[model samples]
Target: MRKIACSLLLAGTLVFGMANSDVEASTHTVKNGESLWNISKSSKVSITNLKKWNNLTSDSLYPNQILQTSAKKTNSASNGISAKKGTFKTKSNVNVRSAAGTTNKVVAKVKKGTTLTVSQQKKLGNDVWFHVKVNKTSGWILSSLLTSANKSTSKSSTASQNVVDQAMKLRFIPYLFGGTTKNGFDCSGFVQYAFKQSGKKISRTTLSQFAQSKKVTSPKPGDLVFFKNTYRKGISHVGIYIGNNKFVHAGGKQSQVTSLSNSYWKSKFDSFKRL
Candidate 1:
């Protein structure tokens, strides 16, 4: 597997928390600030290769849009990149290293729900290594720590759990009215941020998000449960469901996990939507 440029790691603390597992194709959900060239630089896949894989005539991308990063598998790695191919979900929070071994420098820390595209599989003594791509970043992860991405039940469950795990990592980040970064977050901003970290993209504002999603009678964990008239007349707040009738959101003074059954939220409950 070719090495993706590690220089970006020095530029900032890269946070990868998205989880998607598709056996048919290796795909990436474009984030808020990503561009085609940036994706090329990170995945180490040439712009030409990316376009060919996704069948793009122009360099246009929007948040929540899923783009195929590698071609659909046809009995082998058809992308001309890896030898052995499959979509793999990280079994745990893992470090993506610059090389296949621990002696290599750490490039980024990928969260549990993070999905990887395995291009090459290598066995070095007791440690089996897989050269993989996590969103825009490509690196090596241990093979034993991955499971095939073909199980929808396991995939969704793993994804939701990973989303919760990643959200909790930012505990106590102060609430910022319009903030969407790790530094701070508003209600909707926190929801977007959490999903983005988990490798999924959603609309930025509560109203847009509420309008964009499909309403569901019952919410699954990780579904967006919005609230109306929190500070305004209509839908104004959103949070990520975390099972047990609980969700995590940026509320009051900071980001936190709270109960959906809580009197305040329960009274303001608007609807649930699956994205």
Candidate 2:
């Protein structure tokens, strides 16, 4: 009887341990403005482990995507100096290779100002390589050619105001159908240029810009003001709001400052948004 009781107790303990282990390997829902780097840091897991557990090929994350945070009974290691995960930008045009070495085949040539989502890194002697994803393509780039995205986004408020300031300075620039230069600009092109100048990267068209941004109820200076049904149905035009019901956009034959309260504009006004 005594032997049977001992066996039962051991079985119960093992079952309880297994249940606890299952509980340890939990899931997290991705949120807006979150990265695998930040999630790993918050979850006390290595970025490598996070990717492996979640089966993520790239560092990109979207709002509400569920991810596994850990594996049962596995210790979450620290992301050491050899590996990092974050957003980076190309300093200049650079080749993304198949592997960490110069001998690897070049998979893509990324242009300057292109944004990269880095998921992993490897240090080889004096050289370090980052595993980066640009759009849907994944490859490796030399660390020296990459700059941290934080350098631009660290002062987000200032950058936002700078976008408006830059737009305000272009009041009289001529408008062209698809112009993206200082000499001429279309509505979306003007917006893209102003944001780029202020160290923010936005999409090239009004539709893409609207899709990528988050809607806001109370807009501040530098928030995006959208309009619909100006030329076509759905979201058509975009501008940078500069408070007091005013916004700056490429309109008519030139870039101009206009009022959201204006009858034509007010009728077409859509919701304000932020990137």
Candidate 3:
């Protein structure tokens, strides 16, 4: 009887340990400006798995929400590979960096429509970087710059192009404080006027426009690009993105086109939005 009791106790302890191990999983605390897509990229987990694990029915996320990044498994079956392999095409001229972040060296520059084989993905900072092979070069590119080869540009592209065309017509116009006309314009005023000309009416001020627009991850032409702490603190400037890492904005002495890669703008870059 003593031997039987000892064996039963050992079996119970083993079962409890196994159950505890099965329940253990990893979690992430959501941050401001983060989305389910962002978390999926960073954690190397699929959005489907994240939703399933956390019992989320929608993609909506709020700051400081604790989410499970992995699921509990009772069996020895593998969760499968985290990285995806696929054929992708560049949406615009893009830089392939030596590493996963923009701070890394540029290994190559590929033009728009370049075909690439993405073998893996890594999340560095707030952006997802894809490890891609083009020609003989292998480097990292921002996922935002590449789209699935099977997918086509959406219908919104045509509407965005119209806005870009309208904005470009006013290029080289002189900049003026609080100006909103063809005579001269401020940054927000320029964007507002361009959208109005494109048949889309948007808010007139940088703050209000930013507040009213929807945040976007993959910004296209005519999307509103915002910057913080330019002449003043907190979302002080705005521009209309014209794609290829460039935007048309009212800045300096005149309205002009500028590159987002410009050190000053890059440092102050906030987020892209769509009206």
Candidate 4:
């Protein structure tokens, strides 16, 4: 009974995080005198709807914050180090919020991964974005500003929304070596656990799994790919492709998002396959 209760709790939390977390669009710059409520009225999208979409809970905006609309803005690019876990990507939005739980509404597109640190973590009605410390300057940012890269894991096949939805719930779980199920996962363990959620049971090792699945020309939403150097001499670690050129795998400590085009990854690149 205790084990069953724990399983239910974990499943419930994972579902909640995925449902409430909608990566907000990158648009409208926050002017010195502006508020989200006003923007909502102007845009014709209801405040309630906007909050629901962006995972917000208030009615304010900040200066110089770029807001994403339906409009197609040219992609912006920059570079930084890994401030926290996860590969903070090339065109993801970095959200900014205040300590008072008011909407500070500062948003920016991440050019590269920055070692830029975030301190405060506030939860108003259970929305969990971070309070980031801007790089090389004195300013604040909301955890909502960041977005996971939309890269594909493997092109063999596209996963249903349910599968992707299930996989995303484990975004922050720590990587555990030899972990192949729900208790925890290393890169390959994460792959098995996610596939299991979708009613599939995959192999436990990268080398073994790599030999299995059918190779695909391109990566799609839910596919498996392996990496070298991380585990064995040749094909070592594996990850689930999330689209674009990225996959979400449990790196050393946690399961954050990552890419295949980066230096280390590019060099260790292996074949991608659909299961």
Candidate 5:
């Protein structure tokens, strides 16, 4: 009788556990200005699991899109990092960059003692950099400057968004002739930096850039809009097309967002191209 009672108790506990697991599986309706990267980090679910659950083939996500935020079991924590978990804290004042390399644009500076939510880590040379979030900002910080707490989980921004985000971050930087760094930019230099933030390498000059790309008649967001005879003749200026007939570039004095439909730009419009 004792043995039978014990067996019945175990079976009941298993049934309860199964029910509880089902309750944990929940849905998330994506909100505006949110991406799979943002949602995955906040929900502690891996981007891989989020895609798997919702049957997403790409990192593209739309506002009001319904997604599976939870499940009975998921690879949410399997972010390929060997660390026991993803939670971490800054060891010092660390400059977080857009990508894993030091050459990438600095996105944020996390002061010492700040807590960070890690999304993933990548080995760059002999050092590892943790892709982390602090407050609402996300970027990569050297792992040596972080102490993992082994308590959390990770997601990354999509390529197109990354390009736009990087460009937007430098909206007010001064234009420097033949410059390519975040400190300053020329027209083509600005374009190069923006794409590099998304892990895409592009030509360094406006003319070479024009030569490399295939022309597109109907320009889309993320395409390159070229201008002829801005300062010189033929493909001297380029800007990123960001929809709504507006584009961003490092023009005469500084990096600024302008309208493609504006009289000055409209007159010089050569063609739109995609790299």
Candidate 6:
């Protein structure tokens, strides 16, 4: 069984390497005071590598269990080059850590309470920028702007408000793909535009948005649930499944409200969740 990491007790602290994946599940049960870094270090592995092997981002470990891990990347770096590491508190339920240098293309998703690593930064005359790496790739970001992990402040989201308002105002609007205006909209686009109206920063992709929140067995009024079986495995369409087995979504030619208990939606439904 895998042992727990003691370093995790340090209020969102982690010490891991870029590539050291020859990990074995902990043999003993994890006790109260163990940090993930301590366990990895004692086992001669790095935390990053441990995460890579086990696919873990948020920290908290248990005792007496084998961990799922993968082999370390051959080209991964290890030698400590002069680098600066900072933290970014999650403003939303799910935060994206993109390649250090891309206008688009998310590298990985960092959940709340996880410490992100930073390296050689690009400063603007004594100012910090977003020059850090998530899983791979480097990019520019305001270093000073990236809040410390210790900060407890949260980024506000009005997704629920906007969603409800849009549904009410455009109760008759049709659904279309790539349509942002009130004219027509696609499954994901409808949700995006509605949330935008409500003042929430959301992605364009449905699956990406779905990954932003944890799933729920039952949905709330403004919850954005997804459906599939018509295109992909996880989900292909989206809607705001309101209370009483009903939902509002942009589909066919107009944004329409339907029932979650309907045969078509029920069969195609994947899951409902928050963001």
Model 1 TM-score, 2 decimals: 0.45
Write the residue-wise lDDT of candidate 2 on 102-180 in tens digits: 8866768999989999887877678888988888777789999999997787777687899999999888999998889
Per-residue CA lDDT of model 1 for 28-104, tens digit only, reads 66899899998888666789988765535467666765666664532234433336788888889999875567876
**TM-score, model 6 to reference:** 0.42
**TM-score for each model:** 0.45, 0.45, 0.45, 0.41, 0.43, 0.42
Better of 1 and 6 by TM-score: 1
lDDT (Cα atoms) of all candidates against the true structure: 0.77, 0.85, 0.84, 0.61, 0.79, 0.60
Q: Could you tell which candidate, 4 or 5, scores higher by lDDT?
A: 5
lDDT of 1: 0.77
lDDT of 6 by residue, 134-191 (tens): 6543334445335666343222224464567666676677666677777778778788
Order by lDDT, highest first: 2, 3, 5, 1, 4, 6
TM-score of 2: 0.45
lDDT for residue 137 in candidate 3, whole number 0-100: 74
Weakest 10 consecutive residues of candidate 1 by summed lDDT = 15-24
User: On residues 78-125, what C-alpha lDDT tens digit does candidate 4 reach at each position?
Assistant: 111122433223234443333324465334434445545553344446
Candidate 3 accuracy as TM-score: 0.45
Least well predicted 10-residue stretch by lDDT in candidate 5: 149-158
Model 3 spans > 4 angstroms off: 1-155
